[model samples]
Target: MNSTLWIVRVVLAVVFLASGTAMLTLSRARMIARLGAWIEAVPIGAVRLLGALEVLAAIGLVVPPLVGIAPMLAAAAASGVFLVMVGAIVLHAREREYLQVVMNLALAAMAVFATWGQLAS
Candidate 1:
């Protein structure tokens, strides 16, 4: 169970880090090109805010637990990511991006599992 949670944490951290970094660094045109029309609908500042939150949440998911600080923060961070996934699902669904919605659902489930497992332990 611990091993599985660790794997999930690492995988999710990597994914969110990469995704956040891209959002932070990329120009609107590039983001739109890579992410599709969704980027066009959201304000640039809002997009940047989302990027910052994602990066922070990614760090939160790993650091506190690894360093033996507030380890329970990992569960909180997972819950935060779960909220983000919920938002993603809503936006994707509104846009009729069923594929993205499916991806969000999978990620959201992982987030829930990570949080639940960690808190239970």
Candidate 2:
């Protein structure tokens, strides 16, 4: 279970880090434009900020655990990802993008599981 949880943490951390960086830097304009049409929501600046937060969380997930400096950071980072997914679900729902909502929910569940496992161990 510990090994499985570690693998999940690494995979999720890499994914979230890469995706968040892309969203923050490369895809900011496109994302904001698409999301803007819905609720004038998620300003460009806010998107960038969120992206930064994700990157930080991604680092938290991987670094502390591997370095043996408070493994709790890993769980906290997973929790942050879960919170971000929650926001994503809400944003997608408001946009009437049901597919995205489902995807976000799935990601949130995975994050929650990872968090639970890390904290448990």
Candidate 3:
């Protein structure tokens, strides 16, 4: 169980970090090209805010636990990731992007399991 949790944590950390970096560094046009037309609908500031949150959560998910400092923060970060996935699911559903909805659901499930496992441990 511990091994599984660690693996999930590392994978999710990478996922969030990469995505957050892209959002923070990319131009609006680039983001729209990469993400979809939906990117054009959202304000750039909102996207950046989401990116900032993701990056913070990614760090929270890994750093505290690894450093043996306030490890419970990992669970909290997973919870935040779950919320983000929920929002992603909703947005994808609204856009009729069923594939993305499925992807987000899987990510959300991973977040839930990570949160539960970390908190339980």
Candidate 4:
């Protein structure tokens, strides 16, 4: 079970880090091209802020635990992920992007699991 939690942590960390970096680096036009026109509905600054928060959440998921400092941060990070995913799900649903909503649901489930596991441990 501990191993499973660790795997979840690592996977979430890597995925969010990469995703946030892309969001931070990509221009509005490029993001629209790659991610679809849905991105244009969101302000670029808000996108960047979300990206930054994601990067922090990614770090908070693993680093504190690994360092034996404030391990509770992992739970907090997972909670944050879950919250962000909720927003994403709403946005995707509003846009009628069912596929993206599905993906968001999966991530939210994972985040919830991670949060529970972290708190349990």
TM-scores of the candidates in the order shown? 0.96, 0.85, 0.96, 0.94
Would you list the clashing residue pairs of candidate 4?
none
Report the lDDT tens digits of candidate 4 across residue range 33-121.
86666788898889999889999999999999899999999999999999999999989898999998998898898899999998888
Q: Candidate 1 — what's its lDDT?
A: 0.90
Summarize candidate 3's per-residue lDDT along 1-121 as a digit string, tens digits. 9999988998889889988888999999888877766676678999999999999989998998899999999999999999999998888788888988998888888899899989999
RMSD of each: 0.9, 2.5, 0.9, 1.1
Candidates ranked by lDDT: 1, 3, 4, 2
Per-residue lDDT tens digits for candidate 2, residues 32-106, read: 555444334656677678879988988988899899999898899999999999988888898888987887888
Name the candidate that leads on lDDT.
1
Q: TM-score of model 4 relative to the true fold? A: 0.94
For model 2, give the 10-residue run with minimal summed lDDT: 31-40
Q: In terms of lDDT, which candidate is stronger, 1 or 4?
A: 1
Tell me which residue pairs clash in candidate 2. none
lDDT of 4: 0.89
Task: Please identify which of the two predictions, 2 or 3, would achieve the higher TM-score against the true structure.
Answer: 3
- Which ten contiguous residues of candidate 3 have the minimum total lDDT? 33-42
